[model samples]
Target: MENTRVLWLYIILLCHYHWFFEEIDGLVNLALKKPAIQSSTFLNLTASLATDGLIGTRSTKNECSHTGVYHRNPNPWWEVDLGGVHTINRVSVLNRAYFAERLRDINITVISQDKTVTTECAFYQGSVAAAAWATVTCHPGTSGRFVRIQIYNEAYRDVLTLCEVVVEGLSPCDAFYFRKHPGQRLNSQLVEEIQSNKPMDCGKACFLTTMCFAYNYNSDTSACQLLKIGDPCDTTVSDPGWDFYSNCLN
Candidate 1:
């Protein structure tokens, strides 16, 4: 009976771990955590309130400020540079145009030195707004050295304005940026000092706090990260924060 109990416990723990990892791709909410992904060369990137002019609005007045470019053909598409090697987990994209058609497909793939694989991360089977936000969950697979996102439907009626694109699972260190300041405000909670004797405190805090979405535990500096979760507006991942802290603080 003890052995059976242990097996059951293991299964439960595994499920719980997967459950905690969510794949939400909509307007962006506290529930979804920002991915830690970087390209091997160019590095993953983003746009901002100042750069785009506003949040939650289709800014036709201005184009994407990041390396992302707007195209006249097949609507519009922006290619993000996911630096380094990684296995993709989840993806989210926004274009916000309906007349462009209901939409069709969302594809996530990777290209390496010798081989290329296309793993269907997420998909929508019809027409969608030119400014529509689409999110896809890719199958959890092995290591992918290079990653790319391709969305398709109607051809170039309008430029596919990509508002946000994100993928989590495995991306190298170059694709992300983690800026840590213990005294700063993340959403609302002020990071006190690095809490010692309780390293997993971040994970524990996530379980207790409703506003809290994700967290990082700095074992060396004894620091904890409490992020202000938002809808893809300012997506931040706390775990990668801990990775940096590991080397920096120690």
Candidate 2:
């Protein structure tokens, strides 16, 4: 009976482990391979390394992003542009294996596309262990186009280093306003015209524009038109080559 109980317990643990991974795999890392920049570079370690999708904690592995020495640089920071605005859920930072204490007193912030708004996602008051992942859950409805991580303190100066920065969130287009109307165009007030290759880009353009309520994308010509007056759900004219997306729903 003892052996049977042990075997059953092992099976339950295995199932739980599988379930945990499955839930994690369902989340989308919005910061993956996005355009990243840092305040300064240490040697050849660039900001892009932090978002390279590698979680290797060793600095020698060339997977970590490092900033200039602390004394020379007062506050070190790394930022990633998520292409467009997103409702951020959480931010995870993987500490370097050698000196994990350097990642302490970090501030993670979210910035708007227009650079007029900023929100603090999380702040770590203490150090994270080497090779360990420090995850911070953002407040509900925390949304932005840029995610920035910085280390700053008057008493202590530390270079910012990150093995990997994972941001999980929902894209702006995933909201209720992102209804697609294919082969249609909103004949409303025109805001501006820009070159775009895909519907998603057009939607992002509309989202960034203050007066833009909708956008029309022409797949054949790669032309994007921002509209000011109405959305795609309103009275739209049939245009086989154009696709309409509304940014006013949400």
Candidate 3:
């Protein structure tokens, strides 16, 4: 009976250990099979190949995503959308077997969901070696939905090639959730007003603005008013052509 109890305990601990490792592995690669886009494609090598979960560094094998040549694409860039805002930890890039020096002077940036705010994650001044992995730890508090890798040198045009790009991060649950109120407008604490025809654009404008907590979009006049306070229904007044979007959940 003692031996049987010991064996059962060992089995339980082994299962728990396996489950813990699996959960950790799931958070290691957030860019796998995500929506990826690039400035231009070279031949048939598309942007999606970089996030296809293949780490093969041979460009001839068609496992890498390549951009057009210097003259064709002066500023080559590659980006991956993480679907939602996430706190990015690090980004890894695998260089192709041939011509790995093309990735020199590349800048990695994290862009907000509205595409208005950009934060530099890391920059590689030197060329990454052929068939090697270059891992970049993002700056503290770097969070965004889009990860962009681009060559910023204007002296010469360089093609951006990525064999495999991996992003590891944490996806927080308390993301911004906008609630819309039709025929209403928040009347107080106006920050800035912009001409925007769509409610999505108005919401995005408010999202990147640090002082904007809510926004009112006028349908008839195409005016978007960003408000500093987030009193959704309490402070809003009835407006015939305006709609209010609040980021406050409670």
Tens digits of per-residue lDDT, candidate 3, 1-250, equal 9999999997886565443334321345768899999998888888999999977987778999988764467768999999888889999999889876677777899999999999999987877898899889999989999999998656545588899999888533223545667888877788999997677667666766788877888889999998887454448789899888766443
TM-score against native, each model: 0.41, 0.58, 0.59
For each candidate, what is the lDDT? 0.41, 0.80, 0.80
| Tens digits of lDDT, candidate 2, 116-219 | 99999988788889989889999888999999999875444548888999999844343324556779987887889999867656665676678887778898
Model 3 has an lDDT value of 0.80
Off by over 4 Å in 3: 1-21, 153-156, 171-250
How far residue 244's Cα lies from its native spot in candidate 1, in Å, is 16
When summed lDDT is taken over every stretch of 10 residues in candidate 1, the lowest stretch is 23-32
Tens digits of per-residue lDDT, candidate 1, 115-164, equal 45544445555544666556666665634544455456455333333445
Output the worst ten-in-a-row residue range by lDDT, candidate 3.
17-26
Look at candidate 3 and tell me the lDDT of residue 35: 91
lDDT at 106, model 3: 77
